[model samples]
Target: MWLVSFLGKTITAAIAAAVPSCIGPLSENIVYPFKVSDNVRALVLTTSALAAIQADVQEKVENAELQGLVQNNQVKQWLDQVEMVRGELDDIKNRYEKRLRCLGDRSFNCWSNYWISKDAKKKSTEVQELRDRGKFEEVAIQITPQVQEFSVGSDVVPQEEADLQEILRYIDNDEYDIIGIWGMGGVGKTRLLRRIHNHCKRSSDFDVLFVTASRECSVEKLQEELCDEHGFGRGTGVVSQARIISNYLGNRNFLVLLDDLWDQIDLQRVGIPFPLGLVNQFKRKVVLTTRLVSVCGLMEVKKSLKVVGLDPEHAFRLFKEKVGNETIHSHPLISSLAIDVVKELNGLPLALITIGRSMYGKRDPREWEDAIDLLKRSRLNEIETTPEEEKIYYKLKFSFDSLESAELQNCFLACSLWPEDFPIYKIKLIECWMGLGLLCAFDAQNIYNPGYTLIGKLLSACLLEEEGSDFVKMHDVMRDMALWLVHTVGIQGINGLCKRGLELIKCYTREVVGFMQSGRHYLQAKN
Candidate 1:
């Protein structure tokens, strides 16, 4: 053994002396070339494992985004590094492939083989490190410091600011669990709820979920919306969905915002751990916005707030702002004309914004004068309504009439056929419009463009509200106006169709039976 070691040392010294600078490469050439194939194999295996983990992380990210959760910054950086490593691996593979071919029992370029093997071994180590790093316990996080800034401007009406503060105080009070915000349609109840949602996100430690309840609010529909937001699938029944929702929410502190609730939705039935006080030592609360004061009582709200319309001064300021300073300054009389318009609108937020937008660039005094005249006529024409309701509906009609085309008007009016606060599916509404011949198609294939275009026009006019990409909704007051236009004004096209359809389908009232009777009478007369 000593003789063999002495011979090995003598050979190594002779080689180092032959070329001192080549010693490093000569040793690596002997050591690494034999391991070249093994290193390449290990690299491929490590990369495959990494790819599998990357796919899992990507899927988790996509699911989290669907639930409105943001990914953690470290997770995002690791994903970026994974992509970069993939590019580097590709380069390494290409360089290895370009190496000189090996002949039987000998390499054509030993140095090339040695370098390629060395690079593969190093990259395999790095790839394995990345694989281990990718094993995260939590990949995504809830939106942090969740307060999103709303640009309501510095001129927020004092009443609204006060209302928001009062509501926040109620929210802080543990005794008030179910808080209700009730007001006339377009009086800013929904806006107040949104502000409260933002406030909860900022100040509170609870997980905040803001949802718009259906107009025909049902426990099942509410459950479905909540389930969708939480990435929960629709279960076998409401009971199952509720159980899943209850289990998930029961684990955390939660604040739920339910907007535009027209009727009472049972909190417990929708999967909320109600009376929230019993929630496993965690805090939970429900805040809702509704048009009906009775709904507040029906929901057993601890405290209910009435969101009143803006005062006259704030109303005029809001109108002028929406009308633009340029238009208001165009003629000295335009501002006064705007004040007249505001008076016609009755300090209602929706009417003010809609009418003001419609009058945005009208520099002509006659245009303002004409708008005022038509608004008065619209108000005078309506009957069987309270003063406040009458003002909003008729003032909204001016915007409806200002729709650039008759098709746009009909399309806007058609939305009112569904139940109040119901999200009318866009495709279904367009199909109905096409069936009614409201959309004149150049060809069968070309039909959808006109339908979507008309819907877009109505949306721009604020006559129709967007529920999501899939649905549009008509405000309750706007629907009432459409019905009024049909029954009282006798428009006789889509309007007539809406009234007849609503009576027959939505309401099993005397009007429906009367319509069938009238149809029989017409048939008898013809016979």
Candidate 2:
């Protein structure tokens, strides 16, 4: 029976091997049954084989379903994470883009999506030739154009006359190596220095004459000037050039005008070398003009000058020169007013010159009075009417416009409310300012002790005139200008006061009506 069963099983296997389509049921029933010997064993083997096959098939199907679910979830999760990362990256890109834009308009290329290789080098000759002949040559050869160069004037001036005189005396005494002239703008400083330069040049006190140090003045320019003045070789390098010039000037007496000197300039830095210990080796006199007095002080000169305004007589002469002689007599009434006008000018040469130039050729008394009236009415605006007036207008405007803070401008305009030539007591001015609520937002320190600070800013800027120890005054013209600015700019300092007055009137009216109503109510109650 075992031999017969084995033979049957071998036949079933052969048939299944011949055709796989028949293997499932053949292996499940025929061959599988034959492999078992006893009835019970055969039955158990067949049932167990069928059951194992079904279980294997079911497990494979379940595994396939589970794998599909896992893959779907993984894709969804990965997509969500990718979206989050993408959002973060976008936000970072936007922030940097805004920052780059704020840097300048030239940064627009960063916004355009483009790729530039970090290690890119100039193309080889052959590759460049090919690129030049290619269709993309136009795009490849595109380049940004250079910006246009602009010319600007030097915004520097000379020192005052008193300062000039002091400098002159120092030169005469030969006490110092260099004399420096320094002061702020509109102080007639540059004019004074020029005058000194012209005077000294004519005197023949020095053998060689040269003026250098202009706007953007460089070592090369100085070297060139020095070389040209002494007829030396115009060498290329700064050190070589300067050394050549220094050697030539060593034994010669020279007057060098280093005009418009900036702060913290070292002669050695410009490549000009003199012997270490020789105090007056060349007697090379250098006159420097600068806005900073500290530069002059730093040079440790024997004499320093601080330029100030002219005296009354000099100011009068300066004014008359501007007005011209023909008009001086024809406009006697105007000329009579001229003395008062000069007084109002407060000895400023620029102011006098500007006012006189504005009144030039106009001999009409009415025109003079009108000009004066305009000056009284609106200081800056009146000056704007004529080209001559424009100069004084700009000078005053610099003082007025230099105020950076709006609160400061308000404080300045509030000053215009007072009568012309009125002497302002510091305490009283503070009280008025406080009453007007100007001090509400300011710090306690500024509110309580703004005397020196406020006056100093105004005085230095030439906005307010200092009257004695504790008083302040404004120029009549400046006062009118302030008033005009207040009205035009609609400054809240004066407007706020007017608004408060209106509010108080409204409140009083409301109180009176309420009182009348109460009286009526009392009469009704009594009846």
Candidate 3:
């Protein structure tokens, strides 16, 4: 009996100690409903506090999302719960507003009042808990384990691999904000960027945004793409969109990959956070690929990497791969002749691929010999691109020369009339070809098949690139070559107006700008 009494006394003392710590908060809920008007007032106050916190949290979430970040899972759930609690509170308020009166409308209905009061007290507790939980120190978190995987294939030669490593090192360095990759047209700048983009080893904190600023890419168009990605509405003017983009990207770490940039793009105008100092916490980066070295200087790049032509050994390997072993080994001398062709190509990847595909299945040594002589004679002395780049165009010309018919050649050359990187509409281009007597069929409607056939041949020869079903675009190098041919071969009626080199075009642009500013006028403008 003494042990039983002692055990009961100890248990009672433990229960007394636990009640205040454990059930003290729960006890408030028990008594809150009976407080009537106090419960409703408390509920309103808690709801207001929760709503303010929700707005702040919502703003943080939206800003993070605009910076290309995803919200934390816990944060997302909390938001959902907040929404649910808001709906419940609204229902409680509506029920209280429609309260019934009993005892000849002299007093409130006891059961109805108790029911509404109990729900309000419960919801007030829930809202208070939510308000406390919504006090997040950081509303967004970096997405984890982001792996961008790219195939490191045979196409990425030793030099390119070295270039890739160098770029990766720059990305790792804290100092480099804007890294520039510049080379001649078709020297694999875009390809190198692709490798960098898909590389799985890059930092996961950085959200890589790849934008191709082709020769024809405009600031407005670029903004629209960014706005669309950020879920911002467009048709707002460029300034408004720029402000929106600047505000959104200002808070996040990002890597912007701008490919094939022809001119200096205004980073400020485009709304990309620029000139990111070492002091800045956000480790933002901009990697741009351009053909002009001057553009690197203009953009104030921290480090500039130039992608040059492939070396002779790798060049020949790429050429032979495209030409195939069967064709090269068919005749003993054809292997030696293939080396001569690679030499004429000057190790340019575009030239090598174009000429190699053209030479596929050819077993004749004499044919290879003739190709070498044609390449030797095809060099243009006066051109805007460097002497090295000129070699690429002349080497690519071998493919143009090998096209089956004169009509096909004209049709391919005609595509150069469009600006660089312009997407030439297929049917319109075909109609132009038909108008220019480049293609003929039995009926007007039947000309499309031949036009498409010519386009296929051009695409196969690597002259024209297909841009979806309705459009085709000329590779910048190919367009340059066509323009060179237009000038050199005296394609009548298409003179200096359309025949000048790319550098000459840049010079002309500067001159026109100067002329416009200087108020100069010429009655007769010479081509």
lDDT of candidate 2 over 151-240, digit per residue (tens):
112322232445656767777665566776665434465566666666665575454344446434566666665554444543447765
Give the C-alpha miss distance for residue 351 in model 3, angstroms.
0.5
Best-to-worst order by lDDT is: 1, 3, 2
Instruction: Give candidate 3's TM-score.
Output: 0.62
User: Could you tell me which residue pairs clash in candidate 3?
Assistant: none
RMSD of 1: 14.2
For candidate 3, the lDDT comes to: 0.73
Q: Residue by residue across 1-527, what tens digits does model 1's lDDT show?
A: 44533554465456556655647777645557555656777888899899999999988875664444556889899999999888888887787677635432223465776787888899998898999999888877764323343333456689999999999888788888888899888888877777787777777777888777855568887877775555553456887667656656776788889998877667898788755843567888888888788989998889999988889999999888888999999999998998998988878988998888899899999999999999888755656655655556667778877888777777776665555556788878887676555776787777688888888877876778777677787777777777666555555444232244335343222232234334431111110
Compose the digit string of candidate 3's lDDT tens values, residues 1-527: 44533554464455555667567666544443334445676898899889999999988877665554557878889999999998888887777667634322111355665677788888898998898898888877654323345444556799999999999899879888899999988888888987888872364667677777877677897887665444443324777566656656677677788888988788888877666734358878889999889999998999999999899999999999989999999999999999998988777888898889899988999999999988887764435655656666667778988888777777777776565556788887786566545567776667588888888888887788767667787888898788777655444331122113353232222233233224342112111
Estimate TM-scores for all models: 0.61, 0.39, 0.62
Which lDDT value does model 1 have at 141?
70
In candidate 3, which residue ranges exceed 4 Å CA deviation?
1-154, 200-203, 216-218, 225-232, 277-280, 379-388, 443-447, 467-471, 492-527
